[model samples]
Target: MAEVRTKSGEPAKTAETKRPKRADALRNIEAIIDAATRMLAVDADASLNDIAKGAGVGRITLYGHFDSRAALLRAVADRAIAQSDRQLATLDLEGDPRAALARLLEASWELTHRYGALVIAASQALSPEQLQRVHDEPAARVRALLERGRAAGAFRDDTPIEWQVTVIQAILHGASTAVYRGEIAAEDAPGLVRDTALAALR
Candidate 1:
């Protein structure tokens, strides 16, 4: 996400007199995003008008915020990814490597399952490169964690990090699909993925 910042490297402050309007705009944006996320999860083809109504905003307001359906969908995807990034950032990255991997997997597993519908829908509607970008940062973090594990002799060193990252992510995505399809119950998914991924790493 682009930060609205000044040359002094601080977040650009809203004027005192305009703060209320700024707050309203932020609230509307959040409302739109929240409403759209729920709507798209239920029906991938949900209309913009429906989203606007759900958000208690008008069509013009929605359009003013997102401009187009594709843009809104991309924002949905980006917001989800950004949220996970923020939550994952709070985890201890310097702890025991295996424990760190478990922490990461559990966090990712839940997110993948929760956002399964949105992820599937967005991938189909958005550009290929945009979808790839959504996956890239998580994959990089996974790669770094695996490297740490390998260094600690907690995971196999022979396997390439790239392949490990790919397979781990593939497994998480597959587990998420299983949850959405009712093949694996949602509550059971994280543990299943955690164990399977640990086996692969070990």
Candidate 2:
């Protein structure tokens, strides 16, 4: 086995040798993204200054990572998609397709509720083209779940997959808004969304 040496002249472990830590700017970007997500959860209208304050960085530094609020939102969307991708990967769809569909909806509603303002800001403020990669592409995972349910005869044969996608995605969006506005409890939203999806699939 070849022993790797670090810049410090010490033996480099396998993990560290294989994948180095994130660059300074990348770490800062991730910190800012996390701060922005927290701020958005509390204040959907949080400004760049607000996010900067949350991250304990100057507005200029925040801008260095993201040129504009829309740009920041896009980055945030990418982060969300990355996290969501992990969860989607581990899901087992072998059970009842309707139950699986319900689980999918519940998971989406939970994610939306947890990241409500970020979703709202990204959808409304960021250009669709900018969010296409993260926002649009990741939705294909959800569509796959719906397709599986359809193939299993759990979903209505007449229902279009895209229609189901649109409906479920739209409801989750609405549920997020409702949670942000305090019009509905976040805990209740998932159950309601699951019920609605079950009804629609019938």
Candidate 3:
């Protein structure tokens, strides 16, 4: 029997051998993503050159990790979404649906405010299907909470649950915009979002 060999007539590389050098590469990737997140949050049209500089990396280094601005933006949005998921998962959402929602809103608002216009950048870069999948988990959390609230008579059941979820998302997005435009104080957005959503549900 003949043994298989690589194109170079050497044994195929093992998984461990194929692994990229970790420390520096990981640090550079994280730095680039962090910088992209910060810059994109402030300006959806923030240039890639600016982001690379903010990351303390040369343009070549940024391009080495992320092929294009869209790729980097996707990475930044993914990290933000993952962090938001972990934070939301920690909340006690078992009782008093309204109170639970208020807690959720407070946390969600913090994330929304932190990420700001990054969502707009992501929407423009990612396809709608990709964006929807990214939001699925967080949206499911709200949908589940709404189902509970409606079942317990804590929230109105007149509208579709999906519509309610859309409204909640809109309110959060609008609040973020309001803060950016100086129409509403950031400190007051949580309470206002909570009140507005709860009232709308009723």
Listed in order, each prediction's TM-score against the native is: 0.83, 0.75, 0.85
Residue 107 CA displacement from its true place in model 3, Å:
1.1
Global lDDT of each model? Answer: 0.82, 0.73, 0.84
Name the candidate, 2 or 3, with the larger TM-score value.
Answer: 3
Q: In model 3, which regions exceed 4 Å deviation? A: 1-20
Of the two candidates 2 and 3, the one with more favorable lDDT, higher being better, is 3
Pairs of residues at least 3 apart in sequence or in different chains that clash in candidate 1: none
Ranking by lDDT: 3, 1, 2
- On residues 64-173, what C-alpha lDDT tens digit does candidate 3 reach at each position? 77887777777787788778888989999999999999999999899888975787778777777768865687789999999999999999999999999999999998
lDDT of 2 by residue, 158-197 (tens): 9677887788778888887877779988779888888877
After superposing candidate 2, which stretches have Cα over 4 Å from the reference? 1-23, 124-127, 133-135
For model 1, state the Cα shift of residue 133 in Å: 2.7
Candidate order (TM-score): 3, 1, 2
Model 1, 1-202: lDDT tens digits are 1211222254447366556765677788789989989988878889999999999999998887777787788888888877878887787777898888888999888777767688777786668886776788789889889887898899998978899998999999999778767898878888888899989988
Which residue runs of candidate 1 sit more than 4 Å off their true CA positions?
A: 1-22, 124-129
Error of 2 at 198 (Å): 0.2
In angstroms, the error of model 1 at 5 is 11
**TM-score for model 1?**
0.83
